[model samples]
Target: MTDTDVVVIGAGLAGSTTAAILGRAGIPTALVDPHPVYPPDLRCEKLDRGQVAILQKTGLADIALAATTFDGAIRDGKAWIARFGRVIDKRPGGQYGILYDNLVNVMRSAIPPDVTNVVAKAVHIVTGDDRQQVSLSDGSTISTRLVVLANGLSVALKDQLGIERTVTSPCHSITIAFDIKPRSGRAFDFAALTYYPERASDRMAYLTLFPIGASMRANLMVYRTMDDPWLREMRHNPERALFALMPNLRRIIGDVELVGPVKIRPADLYVSQGHRQAGIALVGDAFASSCPAAGTGAGKVFTDVERLCNVHIPNWLASPGMAVNKIEQFYDDPVKREYDETSKSWAYRLRSMSIEEGISWRIQRRLRFFVGAAISAACKIGVISDGDQFVPEGWTQRLRDRT
Candidate 1:
């Protein structure tokens, strides 16, 4: 039997990040996972600028950025836009493209030397007001003050503890991933490209093209069933199915070829029920599952790790034993709740905006793009105050004065 102040189950990004933070803070922590070298798993491959900012706040951004190669621009079929510069200019980071397993390894590598790393499955967990005991499959036991569940959507652990999942949508969205290659046997024109669904029948949300190391990767997001024929075709013959669905991308990609097998992921939205218990807490996908189309999966998990490690855990530890009241404070946290809600909302929006045939959504779709275009035009023409004004900032002003 081994004992520690905190024991975190699952050493993926969420658990590893939590362990790293708590370990660095000089807290006795233990992180356990089934795989010492995590195998390949499909999830969010790239981190947007917004997600990057949250990671930056957690002090792990530099470590993650150091492991990847990024040049800071993405082309969305039309033209190349400086994604990091336009949205998060105040911060100096860009969209980062990294493999999911690589990311988890990088975070796990940052786990403090003092924190214990247990390589076994957490079979059962028993929680109490003062202490929690976790039983590993290897016949070892861990007794700790608190247990952090960062495991993704695994009900066996939660079910044993009498926790239920209130599912919002059982089969919310479908994601397909494949490698990108040029038919001419050369490099692509752009570093990255994001192509939106062309018509209503396509049933696609968007297709993101980005680089992961030397290989270009394409992730196609759609709102469809797992058994849909199109999905079958994608699995059997990915190249043809992909081109048939998003034909407009042919021009941008020139001649395209797919390198490996097409991977399919069915995303389900759900929030854990009865998880705010004494001496135990949940984080990352264990707390809630978000739609991949919404691109809120990583952001929500980062928020969970950030809030739990930095704010709530410190306050919880300063007191006596881990109680239900201390655990509830984290579940009721304003920022964490907001991010979870935003993910749910965006999941609905992405599905409706792609497949909804009603007049309301139709009008909304047009207006959304129109508003974005109007804002871009306003920024370009230097309309500072009113509609018909050309007031550029800094260098443009100096050029106007010279004229």
Candidate 2:
């Protein structure tokens, strides 16, 4: 049996970052993962400016930025991508575009050399008053003061620990990812672009196009059932189905050909309850899964690692045994609570914005794109100065009231 101060399961972004931070602080931390090399996974393709800031706070900003780089875009007028790029370039910490697997590997590789890397699955976790015991597939055990669960959506570990998730929406949204290249074999004019859905029948929230490496990646997000005929059509004939769903994509990205298979993921919104247990804590998707459309997964996960590693854990270890009260502090953290609540609200908003057939939503949807285009036009003509506060106060809520 080996012993450590903390055992971080699931060597993903959240887990690896936590272990790295603790190890840097000279804490005895063990990171366990089934695979020595993280398998290719398709999740968040790009990180917005806000998420970059959060990673900066965790001291992993350089690691993340180096993993991948791409230009940022917003759905404004035709020139919006240019304007957005200028702003991003001027910002302290700009956005990033990296594949999910590359991002996770970069974080894992950055873990301090002192941290123990266990290449085995954590079969079971048993928590107690003074210590927690984690049984691995190799028939070895690790006794630690705290356990950080960052295994993402897999609930087997949580189930053994008697934790249940409160699913707000099952199959809340659908995401399809694939690679595309210009038909003429020429590079795209822009580094990235966001194309919004123009028709209700498309049932799409938006289509994001960005460069991952040598090839351009396309991620189309929509609010529809997996059984929907369109999904099947997309899987069978992605080239035609995708362009049909979002005709504006061709105009924005130019003529392109599919270079890979269509990858589909049905996102579900869930928050783990009954996780404030002694000797253990949950973070990332294990604690609460976010809507991919909302783009809050990285933010929430980074915040958890930041709070736990920088603030809560140090204070807890300075004293005695890991108690329920000590672990509860992480759950009740104001920043963490805010991130959780905001993620839920964004999930509801993104879904409602896409599929709600009500009159109010109809008007809001139209205005959202219209206002964005108008702002972009204004910026181009110098009607609205850069760095100025726009958007008339009370105008947004008044529109919601149908005033």
Candidate 3:
């Protein structure tokens, strides 16, 4: 039997990062995961400036920088945004491109020497008001004061704890990723590019191309069902399907060749119910899920980790028992709630803007592009110093308010 202050299940991005922060603060934490080294998976591969700042707040910025394969800061912090086969705007870019597994491995490595690494599966968790017991597949038991569930999309443990995840939207969106390079073996014209969809019927939200090491990575998010024929065609002939959806893309980026396997992930938006229990806390996807198109996964995860680790945990530890009321405070955190709600709102908004063919939606979509083009023109003519000024006052503003 082993004992610790906190037992973190699932050593992926959320779990590993949580353990890293807690361990750095001198908390006795035990991180449990089946694999010593996380395997490659299709997840958020790009860390935008907002996410970097959030990680910086948690003091994990250096760890993230070290794992990144491509640093946009080195390229003068510029990425082109295009629509209708032409560049529409340029945004400040400190985005980092990295493989999901690579980032997880680096995070796992950063776990302090004193933090115990339990390389085994957490089969069951027994939560109590004063103590918690986590059962590992290796027939080991870990007793702790609290359990941080960061397993992400795994429901067995949650089910055992009687926590239920309500799927708000089924098959909310699909993410397609692949490597691309010009057929002429030459480099792309820009450091990074985000090309918006040409038509609503195409169901594409956007195609983002960014550097990862020596290769240019492409991530396409679409509002499509799982059994859609387009998905089948995409898996069979990704290049053809991609170009068919965005015919003008070839003219803008020049002819390109697809390399490596095309990775696809279908996301479902969900939120956990009955989670405000004693001796347990859920973070990241374990608590809820967001659409990949929203690009808010990392931000949500970072916010949860920051709030739980820096604020709630310290306060919780200072008290006697891990009661339900004490655990509820973390869930009720304003900052954390804002990020979670923003992710949900963005998911619905982006999907509607991309695929909804109603008259109002069509008009709104066109108006959105018109506004973007106008903003681009204004920035070019020095009418506005920053294009971000024209951005709306809702979720975007909330994201910028990191304080």
Best by lDDT: 3
Per-residue lDDT for 265-299 in model 2, tens only? 99988888788899998999988888887778888
Q: How many residue pairs clash in each candidate?
A: 0, 0, 0
List, residue by residue over 1-403, the lDDT tens digit for candidate 3: 8989999999999999999999999999999999988999999998876777788878888978787855455365568878888886675555689988888888888889999998899998898899999999999999999999999999999999899999999989999999999999877878888898988888889999888888889999998898899899999998889888888888789888889999999999999998989999999999999888888998899999999999999999987999999999999999999989888988898888888889998888777756665654665677764534565433332332210
Clashing pairs in 2: none
List the global CA lDDT of all models. Answer: 0.80, 0.78, 0.86
Q: Give candidate 3 regions above 4 Å deviation.
A: 69-77, 373-403
Q: Per-residue alpha-carbon lDDT of model 1 for 1-403, expressed as tens digits?
A: 9999999999888998899989989989999899998789998798865677789879899998888757354332222322211221111124578888999999988888999999999999999989999999999999999999998878899999999989979889988898989989987766666666656677888787777878888888988888799888888888889878876567667778898878888988888888889999899988889998888888998999999999988888888889899999999999999988878887887788888889887787666555545544554566633222354322232221111
Off by over 4 Å in 1: 71-93, 379-403
Clashing residue pairs for model 1: none
* Angstrom error at residue 232, model 1: 1.1
Single out the weakest 10-residue window by summed lDDT for candidate 3: 394-403
Give candidate 2 regions above 4 Å deviation. Answer: 72-94, 374-403
Q: Supply the TM-score for candidate 2.
A: 0.89
Model 3 per-residue lDDT at 384: 62
Worst 10 residues of 1 by lDDT: 84-93
